[model samples]
Target: MATEREIFSNSGPLDLTAVDWTNSQHRRTVAASLVQGTYSMEHDRQQKLQGHLALGPPWWEFFNFQPVQVLVDEHDLSIFGAIFKFKFPPSYGNYLPQNPPQYVVAFRGTITKTDTKKQDLKLDFQFIRNRLHQSTRVHLAMQAVQNMVSIAGAANIWLAGHSLGSAIALVAGKNMVKMGCFIETYLFNPPFTSVPIERVKNEKLKHGIRFTTSVIKAGVAIALNSQHQRSQKDHSFNILSGWIPYLFVNPSDPICSEYIGYFEHREKMMEVGIGNIARLATQNSLGNLILGATGKDSEPPHLIPSAYLTINVSPTQDLKQAHGIQQWWKQNINCQFKLHQYR
Candidate 1:
């Protein structure tokens, strides 16, 4: 695992204006740096911004982006995210792609520090309960995203977050998609609220368990069909089928590894002539179904309809390294990628 110092340069000013955004490595490194900036702002806000007088400029500046606004948690007054605007215009040159993002909204994961731990963990708990969208932080994030989308078109904006922050971004991005807006998104080690069944070593046992679970979810969905029509959120998934967000996961990271099996198992179900059942099961979690039946609005945070899944196959020493946002910026790591589109 690379240290924070190794992953981020602190020696002197670095320039990335000429870097090719078309390259995946460049994009990943830049996105990770922006996310790291949120952490810096929360802990060491004053020093890092002091240009050459200090050790060096903040990491986001190294990539020719400036923080336009800092997203603060209303309850704790702690910074959790930032909106970055590229220094150059989209029409700058051919170096960047035609539809390069003019603005990026990057969010940091849980910060277990003395100052921010309580609020961060509270949001994490809300995530586990499928209630993150009801939190003030998430609502603020969604509002920030919406304002940015209105100013810069959705095609010119991007969303990136890690761990719990990724869950916030997912909810905001999903809402934007429901409104017929599709923004490019990047998620790193986003927590999936489910049994860590992806860690089961025995393939036969794993497949059997997942198959049974899918059948149960499908049966519940069927039972609820007559009593309750699909929620507006559920119906929006049909529109979300094509807006593919990029998910970065490590097999060793229990917090996010289930994404690998989530998509792969859906393919297996399709091959077995149970595609329709799995489709309904994948979108409607049992918790959401029960809550919806009780006239409560609930949506599963990790029930993404489609994504471009990137799995880090590299070895890690511990869970910290496995789930750390630093892993995404490392160069030459072994990674496997697949685009999972749900019909």
Candidate 2:
């Protein structure tokens, strides 16, 4: 185990493009980097559970199963993973708004049942929680970042994951905050749609907890909430709209479009007459299962057609029915918007 300074000196000038992140050298480099800051590693160790910090065969096995390559520099860290995007139209016109190109970090990982065939529901619950508890993906990520900082300097970091990777990224972001590291996270179609309000609040309280951004195009949020509503708080579980923005992009279908509109206006509509009546009526009839429930089982409201116009790329014939909205409202409402064709 080398100190951070030693590793930095030995590695020479850091070239993110040169490092084969999918190889074992990358892991070793990251591990060494993390151990460099005496205080940082100590802090991470203290915050992590006993078994949670172990970076042994079991931990390495997970990443080996699915390898994702990442590129990091002083300005940003970008991931190249199993995730890729293809647009409908061929070109993303120059007129579209664009955000600063942030570094993308990609991870290839899997989450699986540690145990199966347990008939006792209680036992199953414990098993599942324990499996989730022992995951070391984020810990490894933190280490890699430490290495990056050692070679380069402090940089804005963003984590992106598709499915299971998204959930892992969320967990990793929370763990990083506990370790006193701040990084922004972006998740696309994450498998778990909602998080416990208490957890959400605690994460929000962390000094470095910038935001947990999410993008889910369809009814995934509703379906996930419907299933896990019992464990979440309504108001506490609002979309990660604070510094982190959750964008919901919907294509034009009347019902889908209306649902989007309802999401965009539900909060304000709740303040008026007929809209309030309609909201309450829908809530009662559906067991308060629609988007705006404020209890454990409530769903975050969706952003519809009008909301889409506000956030989406300038409309084209191809975007006839699309709309979008952010989940939280605490951040400055400035996002560079762009349209890309994925076909």
The numbered model that scores best in TM-score is: 1
lDDT of 1 by residue, 1-343 (tens): 2234423464212444455778776787788778877777776543334444332136676777888899998788888999999886465576545445799999989988767899999999999878999999888998899999999989989999999989999999999987889999999999998888899999999999888888998888777766346455456677888789999999899999999988999999998898877787788777787886787757788898899999999999999999988778777679998999987
Considering summed lDDT, which 10 consecutive residues are worst modelled in model 2?
Answer: 321-330
Clash count list over all predictions: 0, 23
TM-score of each: 0.90, 0.30
Query: TM-score for model 2?
Result: 0.30
lDDT of 2 by residue, 87-129 (tens): 2222435533232112334342221222212212332232233
Model 1 CA lDDT for position 175: 90
Best by lDDT: 1
Instruction: Please give the TM-score that candidate 1 achieves against the real structure.
Output: 0.90
RMSD of each: 3.3, 18.6
Residue 144's lDDT within candidate 1 is: 92
Candidate 1 residues lying further than 4 Å off, grouped into runs, are: 1-7, 10-18, 46-57, 89-98, 227-234
